[model samples]
Each structure stands twice: as structure tokens, then as C-alpha cells.
Target: MIAQQAIGLIAISALASACAPELYKRDGIHPAHIQKRQHIPNVVEDTRGWTFDQSEEWNTQSPGWGACFAGTQQSPIDLQTSWGFAKSSPPVFNYPKALKGPLNNWDFGPQFTLAAVADDNTTEASIQFSHDGVEETAYFRSWHTHAPAEHTIDGYAPRAELHYVHYDDAGIPRAVVGFFVDQATAENPSSGSAFYKQLESLALPDIFNNQTIPEITLDLNLAISEVNDYKNFWTYKGSLTTPPCLEGLRWFVSKDIIYLSDAQLESLLKVSTFGARPVHRVWGHQVNA
Candidate 1:
């Protein structure tokens, strides 16, 4: 059955490409009233060099992210623990504590990408939260990671950063919840984030191309528990922190630090050693760390 399904999907993908290129873009994306991404260059085959390490050269080398050097409200800012107002009403996440069976995991060369591909829907997962005057539900369209993290805590960067990218109903990026992971001590080696473990296992092979794992079960709630602490988190307005540097994104940087063992960290580094963007300057931005 699995083989038949895979064959059917390949056939459908081929037919879709051969029949109508306008219906679905050549990159397998369905067109809609999405944000202006035409400025962003194609990255399907250019993953090897266009990484976070070379983000500084994105302007001259990778012209796709020239705005990254010019944008003011960029992301992955250093969370100043002493800043921002402490509100009583914190954000919440309505995610499953555990997933039933296997879920699809994709290897987009530079990093692992996961979404609800089986359903043919744009959103793979989603969660809800309300803070300040902002009451919005975010759908999980896709997720990727940054080794050595993006946002810093009081000037300290974590071992790795898990970015759960969410979008609104209008197909605009609404929020990105960043979970910071630190190296675990001997006393506490496991942080109970099965999602991270699954990602590590799937990406440990380090095949730099388009690949997919059809079935991988994980505890979505445990993953959230690994990072989500209802009381301790920082929220701010920022950009995607990547190419094009599109602004107007909502950022939720978790204050609670999750722990990853040495082996797990090693697995992550093996997959994408240079997938972290340099820390961009943050000036006049609001952050409650």
C-alpha cells in the first residue's frame, strides 16, 4: 500500500507538472494571494552555499536577501531579559501531547522541513495564542532549525534553535515560536522533546538534496513542553531572519531553555553544520525576555 501510494504521488506530481505549470509553480507551490516572494530568488538547487554562515555575503553574493542587510525590523534578536513589560496574561499553545503514528519528514538539503503534505493543505500544523491586544490563531505551515540558535538570551546564544513557522489564514507569516536548546548536563541529559529526537534521527544521514521520510511518529506535545513555559517568554515584531528579510512577522522567543544531549547536538551539526545566520543588530525594537 505504501509503495502504491508513493508511486501514485509521483505519477500525480509528474502529471501536474506536465499538464499545467501555471496551476502550480515549477517549485511545487500553488499560487495564491501570497505575499510578494518574486523578489526572492530560487533556492531549490542553491542550498549548499546559501546558508546562515554566508548570510553576511547575501547582499553581494546572495542577492536574494539584500534586504536582510537593509531591513530594520529583523529577527533573531538578542532577548534582553531586563526589558519589556511583564504582563499577567501569557500566551498558550493548543498542541497535541502525543502524535498517533508516523508523520512525513522532508530533507530540503540545508535543513529538515516538515508539513502536512498528505492532506494537500497549505498548513501542516497550527496553534493558538493571545497576548497583549493580539488575539490570533497561527497555522503551522512549515518548520526549520538554526544551529547555535538565532535569538540570544541576555547575550548568550543556545546550542540550537527550533523555529516553528506559523501563518495566518491570509497566507501571511503571523508568528514564529523559537525554542532555544542548550547542552544538557550529566544530571539532566534528556529534555523529553521527542520531536527533536525524531528530527535528529531523520536528518543524521546528511543527504544534501530533496528527500522524504514517509512515516515517523512523534509526541507533538512533548516537543512543545520541551520549550513552552506559559510564564517565561519574549514576544516582539520581527522579520523572517532569512532571505528577503520580510518584516511584519510576530516572534515568540521562549524564555525556558530546553536541554539537548551531546549525541543529539552532534546529529544536528552533522546534518547542517553552517545553517545559522549571524546575529543582526536590533535597535529600537520591543522585546520582553
Candidate 2:
């Protein structure tokens, strides 16, 4: 009986060894998804908060939907002439000191207010600006969705985009600048830059793109590359370029134009409607050469 029992036990042990489930091996853990855990830093979080009184008092009402637009003086004007060397004009800035209080108190820096305006006699469109500060500039070009127009400049090919400018009640001119870009290249001059890439990598909300969450990180450093050259530019004082257009802004436009590849221009047009906004008249503001 003892020998029989021993044999049975041995058989059971052999079966367990052959059929036992594989040891529960643990798999490597992955790093947390940065996008899932990232947060956008509001640079002007502590700036003076905007109240109903402030908005009403300054005549700077916020846009209800689409874009929270602002009304100002010296809105964007049309670019009718070809690119060429012109005489310089004296810089005339009489920015109101009191107006700085309200602007400086706001939370964000200049918000991008893009408008596509008619250029010259062609059906071309371009972007305009209303930025905070003495001067402002942006590279304008057709996104991947649009074709590039040939021009004397290396990177500037005419597409449909214009640049504009304006000023708030405080006497500070809202510098509207435009950048002409080509989208064909993989390198994104603005978002692709090292700094902007970092901010973009953060995957912040695209306020314009249905607040769609971005997949890539955002690099804030690209802002450092803003053009400072004001030698060649158009100068004038006009009204807010958009609806409810008010008057009284001092404008300065850069003479040097930026370029974008074909791909970039099309990408912009695809997102926004093919036509931005039409360029308004220069309105009697002195066009200083």
C-alpha cells in the first residue's frame, strides 16, 4: 500500500509541473501620458481682471462667440503696391500713459486677431493684427490649402492674406502685423521653433479650432523670434478693422515680409474659411512713407 501511494504522489507532481500556469510575469510600466496630465500656464494670471464696467467704459466689448474680438482705432488697410524700397518716416508715438493701466492689468499678452483682407485689385487675402505694445509683427502666408503667388521676395508668394493695425482708447496702437508663409516644408517656423515647440508639446487647447485639444507639445520660445525691424513699414492711424469698427489708432507696418511654404498656407485656409475678412479703406489716416 505505501509503495502505491508513493507512485501516485509522484505522478501528481509531474502533472502539476507540466500544466501549471506560467508564472505571472509583470510587464514594464510606461511613463504617464504628458498630454493627459499637462496644464496650460496663464502668463497673465495676475493681471488686472476685466470687469463689466471696464469693458463698457473703455468701449472694448468682448465678442460673444467665434472670436472674442476687440474694437479699436487704426484697423488694417489694404496693401496695393508691390514690394520695393521707399523713404522712411519719423516714428510718431503718443501712447496714453493712463491706458497702460487697463492693458497691463489684463491676463494674456496680445491675443491673435487674424483677418483675411483683399489685396490690391486681385482677389488675394492677407491677415491683419491688433497687438499690445508700441509695435507688432507676424509672418503671413497661405497655408497648405492655397497656392503661392510669385513675387520678387524669395519666400513671399502672393496668396490671399492681408495685415492690419489699430489702437485702444489708451492711445497705444494695436500693431497688426502679418507673416507670409509656405506650408510645404515640414519645419514650422512659428510652432516648430525650439521654444514654441516646447509650448506646443504641452498640447494646450486650440481656442480657435473648436478648443480642440492638441496632440503635440507647444513651444513658447518661438515668440522670442518676433521681428524688431521697423525701418521699412507703412504708418497710419485708422479704426478697428472688424465690425463695430472704431477710429483713432496709430499704425506701423513692417516693410520686410516673411515667407511660408505652400503647405503652411493651405493648412491655414483649410482651418479658417477660404476668405478671411475684406480689407477696409485706409480712412483718411495719414499714410506716412
Candidate 3:
């Protein structure tokens, strides 16, 4: 009887281990509520309305939905000078001459998710940034777009904001380079941006296929270089603009705005959610560069 009980216990242990969900590390810390399921969740899978604004289904309202409300450091705040003091010197970006990847395009329910193919050779793509104060290098993970932008800059909301989410070696989100993009008027059409062009291409096709597409390449260097000035930006600490609203993020809102063609903006709007969480009411948390 003793031997039989021990055998049953061992079987149960093995079964539990087998059913355990995969764990991912970020910022050198792992929270039980946060897991990188599917690299990124396709969309708010629950009964929540499609966009981030669906507070009805959030952790705050639902209890344990995630950190959306329980946490104080929510993002999408207005990037104003009065909030935080300016930094004479800010973090510097060490971008590669070029980025290589067999990128995959996911038709994430609300917005498109363009991620690395997750293989030995395909994972080599990354960019680095460092500020004089912080000793660690922030590495690029993936980037995505939102129409009408999320975080506003000095009361001005651009047509779109490209969120370059990056992380450190320990899986901590280091910095997010928010490149604000304006729509080009007929007089000065900003058709030279390759990054937005690539995004448009991916989105346009998905409209027809309605499926995730994998095995594509994008020149990340060319896309980043489209911005005229990367140095003049704002810095702040905030939470992930999305659900779970994870805080402790380092944010950079670039003053150098880029231009996106009307056609490109149209395609993006067709694919992504209207925008993200509203600009929070909290103030006094911005640093000028």
C-alpha cells in the first residue's frame, strides 16, 4: 500500500509539470499575472471590447484581470514639460546600420503584431540604447503601430505613434521610442518613409487574407532613419499602455516628428484599434531631453 501511494504521487507530480504554462522573463522579474503567451496575446481574448478602452473587462473591474487598475503607474499620459524636469542629457540610441529578420505578421484581432520569426538566425535583429545615468543597454524586441497615436506630445497628438518596445538582458522593459508621425499634406507628401510603407504593405494584404502571415523581411534601419531627429525627445516612467498596464517602463517621446502618407495612414487605421487607453489625468511626469 505504501509503494502504491508513492507511485500515485509521482504520477500526479509529472502530470502537473507537464501542464505548466511556459514562462517568460521580463525586466529580470516575472509576475504570476504576466506571461508572454503567444509572444504577445493576439488581442484581449476575454469578453472585453476589442480595444484597450474596454475597461469593463479589465483587471480593475473584473478583479485579477491583470494590473490594469490595481497598479498606479498607468501609461498613455500627456507628455508635457510641466510634469517632470528636463534632463540636460538623455539616453542615446545605438541602432544598427541594418536590422535582419524573418519577421512574422500576425493578424492580431485588433492590431497587427509584427514579430521576429523566433529562430536562431532570425533572432539576431536588435538595437541598443544607453543614457549616461543608466549602465545597461536596452535591446529592441518588436515594434507596432497605433492610429491617432497614444501618448500626446506637448498637447499635440500626431496621426500615429510607432512604439519600439525594447527590453534588457534580464527581460525588463528598458525603453520605448515613440516616433510620432504626422500626415503629409498634398503640398509635402512624406512618401519617403520605408518603414511606414512596409507596415502598409503588411496591413493591406491582411485586409484581404484575414490571416497571419509569416516569413517576411523589413529593413529596420531604414525605417528608424526616416525620423529626422531622434535626440530631441522626452523621457518618463510609465506603464505599458496596453492591458495589464505594467509599470516601470522607460518612455521616450521624440520631438522630431515624421510624416506618413495619407494612403499609409488609411491602411493602418483599417488594421489597428482606434488608439489606446485615454491620456491619463495624472500629470507631472515628463523629462525633456
Candidate 4:
């Protein structure tokens, strides 16, 4: 059944390309095309040789950043304390009940959804879905933290926002996904790939300068197409990627790196400075490649 579903998805992707060349691409559906990426190593390596003149403290404090700086078991590094584990287990639901609407009917389970945006100058991305019937939203934004240090994700350039999961009325997470944008190539508007083109269509204009671009919404189908293979993700329990730094949460990040044009990335930086948080501690969590 899963095999059939995969085949069907591929067919649908092909059809989408014919229907909307600007929205979907023929090459965006392949698992091999979307390669896994390394954030920590990429930043530390600095193959681009970008300059970093800001003080360690200033850089760390820059607009958006955070991680497990206290050396907790957390994988990324700048988080605070561990909530330990929940003693009382969450409710469990039967298969029949699970299929119902608004996951709230179920006891506990993980759900997935896709989001994307694109237009003239910017591309915005996010995932919106209901978990346990509770609806929540997670979008990309520039994030940063102090403890660790100053660093940036290449291609993505300056920063990218990783909106932590949002909770439903029941206090359950509705979604968990990260947002990222990188420099687009001149040859291509963004990645010159079908996936990037899909997002460009929904691009939003800048607020300050109507002529300038701000951020645009990413197409859900295109975004999912970019990361179809889930095997290469890093999974762990941690806190929200934003302030208030809530702890005790599950995080799954794909090792796969998505690309955009440099010009597209520069447009985003114009509106927001840094968008990523520092690496938090691994917290004894096994990082599966």
C-alpha cells in the first residue's frame, strides 16, 4: 500500500508540473534530488569565507539565536534545563478513533502537514495542521541565542526562522517544522529548481517599500516535495526555538539542505537580520544521520 501511495504521489507531482510550471517542477519530487545538509559543520567550516567582525557577545545576542549553552544533553547546545520526562502518560486512542477529525479525538499521536509561499521578491514557509484535534501553526523566522556563540547557516545566509510547534486548546503540539531560505542563483530565480519556482509565485511585497520585497509564503506541495525523504532527519526532545524557551518538546530536522537563489536570500536579510538560533546541547540524545 505504501509503495502504491508513493507511486501515486510521483504521478501527481508530474501532473502538477504540467498544470502549473510556476508552481510545481518535474525534478522536485525525487528523494535523491533533495540532499541532506549539515548546519553545524557548514557554519564552522565557512567555505564562503564571510567576515564576522561583531564581538562574540554581540553576535550571540544578534536579532535571533538560541541553543543549549549550558551543556545539557540537548543536541544543539543553548537550551536551559531538562523537564525530565512526563510521569503520567498521555492518553491512547484506538485506530478507528484516530481517523476522526480534529486529532483531539485521539489520545496521542504525531501528524504532519505542508506549507509554502513564493512571489516576486520573497518566499515564506510554514506548516499548519491539527494534532490531537488541536490546530497549531509553525512558521520560519530569524532566531538566535546567547550562551553558545555567533554563527550563520550558509546558502541560507544571515538567518532563518524556525517557529517552534504551536499547541492546540488541549496543550498538544499541532505541528513541528523549521523554515529556511538561502541565496538564489542568478541563472534561477531561487534554486532554479521547480521547488523554488513554486514558492516564488506566492512572494509577498515589503511593507516599508512597496517596491521592495519582504517575505512570501511557500507552496505547501512544493515544500513537501523538497523534503520527501524523512529518513535523514535528526530527532530529539527539546524546547521551543523561540523566546520563553519552553522545554520538553520533540524536534525532527532533515539533514537535507534546500537551496534558493542568493538574490532571494538577500531580499529576506533586508527585512530581518539573523533567523537561526545557535546549536543547543545534544542532551545524550542520539543524533541519527
Candidate 5:
């Protein structure tokens, strides 16, 4: 009987191990959470009335659910690569060498805002692209990360997603580039592995709070170029994935998948919840690749 009990214990241990993140099997990354050994003062947990936990309720619970559920161009629609066409050209990024800002945890997720004017008052980092034969430029506003990816590629969601928000000359959010992120395991070390590690190391504020971090070590040029080839992406007319779910925003979801390392992701999960809203309908919007 004692021998049979030992075998049962082994089986339970095997099952538990199998459920761990597949990347942790070989990468012995350090635990990234703040412990009793380290602490911050004057920091508070971020708060929010809307959460991705109850995404279905977003249509009614959120104050601006009218557009979120009833709108025709709601964002984060599944992108089909086969829809590629020659009618549009990919946007050209004028991203600078570096950026400095505070990392804040808003209701959606951890947002690295573009400070001072936030996403509205700056054209420092911008993207230039042609849509419908009209050339336009959109300035870099801010960027954020979400888990399980907000946009799915051909109906399959990736491990994570990164969004770079851009505003027009009038300070209106006119463009956003969405990149799917995969886990960088030892078997497949991703181009974004180093970049993401740098971001994960910074001391961060709790959810809904903001922490002033020093000038970041990230290089905007490398961050995007390394992750994507910059030529292959899908463009469409859509709305905001968050509250108010405003419509008429320009979207460029990339075909290239960026890879975030295990350590980087574990650190993020410590501060963020699943942020991908449920996929919306295309409503006849021409998704040009």
C-alpha cells in the first residue's frame, strides 16, 4: 500500500508540472514579483470600474457601451492574411532613438504614456502612410501591452499583443499598430526578447497608479524594426477597443509575430490582467493587407 501511495504522489507531481508555462521548462528565469525584501512607499493599487474579466458585460456595464456593442466598426476584429491587396501601403515610422516616460497602470493595462501632452500633444514619434491615395502622418502618442492578444490572426490568438497609438496633426488618435507577441523560449529566441527584458526590469506602480521611471533604455527604432519587417501588415477602419469604443480609427495589425521572453511575460502578469476584449465584427470594412 505504501508503494502504491508513492506512485500516486509521483503522478500528481507530474500533472502539476505539466500545467506550468511551457517556456519555464528550460529557462530558469528569476521570479519577478516584489517581495517582503523590497517595498515601495506612497504607492496605491490602481482601480477601475470596467475590466476584461467580464468582457461580455462591457456592452452594458460600461458607461459608453453604446458604441462598444452597437457600433459597426468596433476594433480587434480577426485579421485574415488572405485579404491582402495592393490598394494601400504600409506606414513609415519616424520613431526616435529613445523615449522617456512614466509607466502607469490604467484600467486596460500597463500603459507607457508619452507624457506632457500625453497621446494628444506630441508629434515627436510619428508614422507616415498612404491610405486611399491620401498620404498622412500620425504622431506617436503612447503604447501598451495586453495578454492573449487583442487582435487574432485568422481567428487564432497569440500569447500577447503590443499596441503603438498614433495621433494626427489635430491631436486626434487616427492610427494604431498592433503586433502579436509570442513567448521566446530557448528553442526560439525572439527579436523582442532583449527589448522586453529591459522594460520588465523597471520598478512599476500598482494597477491604476503611475510611477515615474527614469528615461527608458528602449530604442524605438529597434523595438519595432526588430519585431517586424515593417512591410507586411493589414489596414482597416475600426473603433477603440476600450471604453467609449469610439469609431473611425485607422488600424495596422502586423503580420510579423514578435516574441516576448518568459521572464518578461511573468513580470507583466504580476501587474496586468487579461486585457483582450472579445473580437468584434468586420461589418463590411475592407481589410487590406
Candidate 6:
């Protein structure tokens, strides 16, 4: 059955390329929007890089950027429950009671920077699991955010999304666990408010404006507990959503949504800009739950 589905998807994907190139422009994403990124302490981003709305054609900056469009396993694909089999095991989180600095990463959103110093070479937090019979461990690196979310589930797009980036013992990119963010309405309240408290603490725009860095801490352990029931996720092999989109990434997107109040949701949106890449093809990759 899986083989037959693979053949069918391949046939569909092949036919998709014959269509006209579809372009999705970035909304209100300009480098000057947040002037002088990484100019402050604990705020970090690639000092020299490209923007989502630079000159329109990103490929002009580098020929390698073509990979962003041409890759077979590019990410942020709309996921469906019927696409994958049961996962072999769930990934484990090893967050400390108190993880340090909300390092302002203008490039991939704010990261909960645990590495105290630039020269530090130690594992701060990690996630361990076995996939395809191979046991692997990835360490926590950054916490990223995107407006209007990224990947959709069964064609339903959420308000926003968050990414927990992890790496190997040597700081190599490993796996990412993503959760969709939903707004709290009078009819539907937030289930993860306890965890949203941490976000409330980080509701400051100074995190992005290169102003005085404030002391912030994260309680991810509490977050995991609140999301215990929603632990179910879909796993797949994909790539980064940004330019020069790299492949071979392990992706786990939560089946549940993280709800936030109007004020809290607005706080996040205040700092976020729309540079989210368009949803790409899933190709023949299998998604696991």
C-alpha cells in the first residue's frame, strides 16, 4: 500500500512542475524594518546575509539559492494524518529547571540561548530518540517563531508556529520539534496558558530592537507537561524553509495547537515579520506519527 502511494505521489509531483512558476511574496519583510540586527548584547543573527524582500530575485545573490526552489524535500509542506505510519518512538526532552538567556536571533527568531559564553562547548539541553532503528541524541540550540505559522495540517493554517531546534553534541543541526499557535477565542480558550507565562515574560520588543537585554528564563518542562496529551506529532524528512534550503533534516510537527490570549498573541506578532517561505512539495517522503 505504501509503495503504491509513493508511486502515485511521484506521478503527481512530476506533473506539478509543468505548471507556471507560482510566486508568493513576503509581506512587510524588510531588513530596515528592524535596523541593525545583532547590534546589541545576546542578540544574534548573521551580520552579513540576504533579506526576504531584498531585490526580489534572491538567486541573484547566490546561485546556490536555487536549491531553495529546486530541492525535492523542501519543508513547510502541508501534512496529513494519512501520509505516515506510527513513529517508532517519541523524542525525549532534557530541559533544565532554568535555561538561560532569550538571545535575540533576528534571523531565525529568538533563541533561548543556554550557552553562557561564545567559547562554551557543552551540551545545555537535549532530545533523545530512535528513528529507523538508529538511536540519536540532539541538543537544544534555539527556539524560533514565525507569523501565520509554517506547515499546515490537512490544509488548516494556524495563527503562528514555534520551532525547538536541536543539534548533535558538536552543534550540528539535528532535529526540530514544531508546534502550531492558535488564538484564544471566547469559545475556545488556551490550553497551554501555564507555559505561555514564559512567553509573557518575554513580551518585550527590546528583544528585537537591539536595546537593553533583559533577564529572561524558560520553563520548558512545564510546557511539556501541559502539552503531554498533545504529544502526538507527525515526523518527516525535510529541509529548512529559508534560502539555500538544506535537506536531510528530521522534522516533528505537533498534532495540537498552542493557544494564546489576544494580548499574548499580539505580543508575538509585534516582534514577528512575514518572511515565511511558501509551502513546498512533500514528494515521496513518508510522514510518521
Best-matching candidate per TM-score: 6
Tell me the lDDT of candidate 3. Answer: 0.53
Give per-residue lDDT, candidate 4, residue 220: 35
List model 2 lDDT by residue over 1-289, tens digit each.
9999998986544322211001000122123222221232111121112321222232343232112133322334454445343354324322221110000100111122212233311112222333233343222211111122211132334453333233222222234333333333344343322322232222233213223232322211132133233446555555433322334544454444333334434333434332223333444655553
Each model's backbone clash number: 3, 60, 8, 69, 2, 0
Q: For candidate 6, lDDT tens digit of each residue in 1-289?
A: 9999998986544332211111111234356644433332223222235555452355565565565666777778898867663445568778897886644534334445455446432456888876566888887765667777889878878888877766665434567778888898777776446666776755454334543234577776765665554357788887766644656668888776777878777777776676455676677445772
lDDT of 6 at 267: 72
| lDDT assessment of candidate 4 | 0.30
Worst 10 residues of 4 by lDDT: 101-110
Residues 20-128 of candidate 1: C-alpha lDDT, one tens digit per residue: 0011111233232112222211112222234455667666754445566877777768777777534534545655543322222122222323334453424435677
Q: In model 5, what lDDT does residue 204 have? A: 60
Q: Residue 238 deviation, candidate 1, in Å?
A: 0.6
lDDT of 5 by residue, 22-114 (tens): 101111222332221122221222123456666566568534357767888888898877776335666787877777655555433566655
Q: Which candidate model has the greater lDDT, 5 or 6?
A: 5
Sorting all predicted structures by TM-score, with the top scorer first, yields 6, 5, 1, 3, 4, 2
lDDT (0 to 1) per candidate: 0.55, 0.30, 0.53, 0.30, 0.63, 0.61
The residue pairs found clashing in candidate 1 are 103-216, 116-124, 125-140
Q: For this target, which candidate reaches the highest lDDT against the unseen true structure?
A: 5
Model 2 accuracy (lDDT, Cα): 0.30
Compare candidates 3 and 6 on lDDT and give the better one: 6
Provide the lowest-lDDT 10-residue window in model 1: 17-26
- RMSD of candidate 6 to the true fold? 10.5
